[model samples]
Target: MTTSADPREAARTRLSAHREAVLALSHSLHAEPELAFEEHKSAKKIADLMEGAGFAVARGVCDLPTAFTATHGSGDLVIGITAEYDALPGIGHACGHNVNGAAAVAAALALAPVADDLGITVKLLGTPAEEYGGGKVYMLERGAFDDVTAAMMVHAAPVDGLGFTSHAISSWQVAYTGVTAHAAAMPHKGVNAADAMMIAQVAIGAYRQQMIPGGIVHGVVTCGGEAPNVIPGRVTADYDCRAETAEDLAALKARIRACFEAGALATGAELELADVGRDYADLRQDAEFGEAYRRSAEALGRSFDLVPSGMRGGSTDMGNISHVMPTIHPSIGYDCGETIMHNPEFTAYGTTPGADKAVLDGGLAMAWTAIELATAEATRTRLLTAHAERGGRAAGAAAAR
Candidate 1:
């Protein structure tokens, strides 16, 4: 019943003991890539692993079938470790969520043994559908993260970064309906849906010049028509609008919707805009936690290029978590040899030796950072005070009731 003299050393030792299983989890996730809310197998594997490690595992915590939570220890300062398991559509694991998920699991396992000693609670969240569907957003709205004092997750990338800003985004699935007629036989009788889509695209492109700084509007036509001989009765497109903040994003979406409406009016076609998942807010990283992660990562030979403020990366549901509590989403680097994220080549390297090393390093660094957060009195008090003010404990109690 003897504990190690240093908790950080003890955590690292525990992580080393579970190294093989951690690497296996990463490889297994890479081999079986699941997309968005369809991460059943991925969620089960992670939950099973956490359960085996003596955590109280809960599945479908926030009404999201693929989402889960695993808890260890009963300390007042709760730390959330997020594991994102969803992959990109066709490319699979292109964003390296396998590495991301495995690293988070590793961090939680590493900290679990020393959690009580450090006066902290470790909560591993099986957060799904980061690629398209905003699983974290849904979970946050449902109070999944309300109890946590702070949260952290490492994302896989070509280079290490302390953290970077992310855009606020809103996406929609738009469709235009019109009369169908044979192209040559009844040209006048047909109101072309394809023409309406084309006009919308043109209007959007023209509007881009007047768009606010850092605001972006982009989309793809999923369905234009079936045959050139027949006028398309329906055309569907997926659109995304993003800006620096929620207010800017709201304005941007309004302008983009106007373009869609104009297309429908000009072609006498009916327009429909279906909401696509939840809106994502801009990321706000906790500076102290970010520095701790950077120090721990650098100790393990990872160099981070601290991105300038206001420079935005892509949107993430994790951004929603940041708004609720102190959060850090740093990028863990691997040697992908010029392969950027979301590419087929990058997906191929997700479970390579470099990626395996990333899983270990990222996990170990996060564990060390969590230990620092617990041990530092000022930092711990600040996080706890903020958590209380936000009604973190009250929300947890309400949810339990």
Candidate 2:
């Protein structure tokens, strides 16, 4: 750490200097929304901005066209700030990823000038498909995060929050196939795939009574039938199962699978359960990281007054990254009336003045958090040790394999 007086002040000044560009970036993302791994334009915007700011930019990282890594400084202590830019299908920026991504960009720019002085590396990861593809999980598995010592990101929400952990979730493409016949003439001669789906839904409803606490099952029937006059030959749906932990989610999936199998047994239909993407693990927030973030956010006049409602947060790929490193996933709040996240109505506020302020504050606070992590003795040592231990484990696993 530098001997300068409160280096956070320097980072704050740099953050303010980047204010116009960051807000413009946020509004641009909100204006032009892209989805999942197809976020080519979004990725370019972030990567270009980071490169212009003197960070080394790598595109198409981890074999994902939309994923990239931008780094400043070559210090031993590496702080990773993840930026998400993918939008929801059909709905644009409803989750305020524009705010989230821009804030992360702001943090990286703010920390760049001080990174060398602080003896820390600032890594800005352009993580895509957070809404559906689990890009962070892919990056974590493929070495995008191997050199990162600690990771952090701010989520867009209706209000500020902290220490709110997310659920472990898995999604599946469910299908049932059977023989088809005319409904009016020979309905009794045909095996009904739609009927099988109905049976499975009923079984699921009944099982809900005995379902494990904190379990969530929800999905959409993408294809139910062809016509009312014809007996359906096939039925397809997309469903997600979530639990408090990865192990519990597996158990929940087993029971859910049985219900689907029961549907097939009753109707003699073929059933298929194909996974959609990588499963997201439950988040494990590091205590010291969370505390340091709280102090930083508090100093910025952002209050964490939202009490815990006991409801588990929605799934995020960052949860998988947090399981491996010291990480903090905080909520950078703004006023959006009574609307909730993922609601299209909430999208309207992503470019508002309050949301702009959130961009600056969230980014500056994160930069400050990084400063504290580098300067504070205990957290600095702990994060460094954890990084070394992770490397050792990776080396040992490779040797054994």
Candidate 3:
């Protein structure tokens, strides 16, 4: 007697077959965490896995060594699954990018066998430098997402559900230059760049009160004077400005720049401001896609705690992609409640059993959602309508402004 193969069952079987390999990949990345723009080892490991799994892998797709793409299948409905593996500056894998990378890989691998039947094409994109360099933004600019219908990724967080909204963000670096002088002797002849930075900080502090609710302005003085005995000639700082929307973020950034300029004008120091990364636009999640993901995840025993509007927020480069195409960035839980992301404690959880489970569950759910969107005409129509509606609203708002 011949057994009939069920697509979903077969996909699950494929995932189980590669379970050990996927977990091993996550462990390796967690053990050897590399900072943004420097994930050479992690990138190579992922590429090797994809190549071994029969994907045609291309490395350095956007001129970044750590960036790559692996594609399988030739169906009309192309789905992009993105993986991020870059670690934080001082803490490794703090944002659970190791798990993110492994899940995306597993999802693509599991869906590979059913792609032909479902009329789906799978593209696994290895996006590096998400923690600092905005790798997705660079990739987007280089036509990486040109042919993709939609993109999906999961983030590890305190809860497992959809993320409502992300704040629009911009990052910049400010450098102050002044003449150096001896502190004890000719202090009057020199302008203290550190003093200029202090002035800027004060200005920012005062400016914070005038900002609207949900607006955020934060910075760190990266460089200060060398010694206490000498007047410092140079100082540098990094500032991040955030707002509820991209337009609001732009206006806030302008005001913050004026504050930095005030520092230069008061202390007679030359001020140089450089944008550190691409502006992280506010995320506009596809409601239809999000609901589909929610249903898929719930079928696997996941719970979502819905929040009131305007209460949830973060910043991500994926927002930029959402503006152009349908996208979803959901949150997967790790049993670390009330624990903040980008923290050392959260990083430790990325390799734990709970995190491993999240990888499997999230990966399968996303893959199933992709299959549904590809094979079901109603789902595709709903997603298309949602995308068009969001685009029209955005256009109307721009025209009104």
> Which candidate's TM-score is highest?
2
* Ranking according to TM-score, highest score first: 2, 1, 3
What's the true lDDT of residue 401 in model 3? 100
Compared with the true structure, all predictions reach lDDT values of 0.91, 0.92, 0.86
lDDT, residue 363, model 3: 90
Residue pairs in candidate 1 whose N, alpha carbon or C atoms collide under 3 angstroms:
none
* Clash count (model 3, backbone only): 0
Off by over 4 Å in 3: 1-5, 306-311, 381-401
Q: After superposition, how far is residue 127 of candidate 2 from its true place, in Å?
A: 0.8
TM-score: the better of candidates 1 and 3: 1
Top candidate by lDDT: 2
lDDT of 1 by residue, 1-401 (tens): 12357887888999999999999999999999999999999999999999999999999888989999999999999999999999988899999999999999999999988999888899999998887879998988888887889999999988888768899999899999999999999978999999999999999999989999999888888999999999999999988999998889999988999999999999999999998889999999988888888888888888865455446799998998898799999989888987799889999899889999999999999999998898888899999999888895566767999
Which digits, one per residue and each the tens of the lDDT, describe model 2 over residues 261-293? 999999999999998779999988887898899
Give the lowest summed-lDDT range of ten residues in model 2: 304-313
Ranked by lDDT from best down, the candidates are: 2, 1, 3
Measured against the true structure, the TM-scores of the candidates, in listed sequence, are: 0.96, 0.97, 0.93
What TM-score does prediction 1 earn?
Answer: 0.96
When summed lDDT is taken over every stretch of 10 residues in candidate 1, the lowest stretch is 303-312
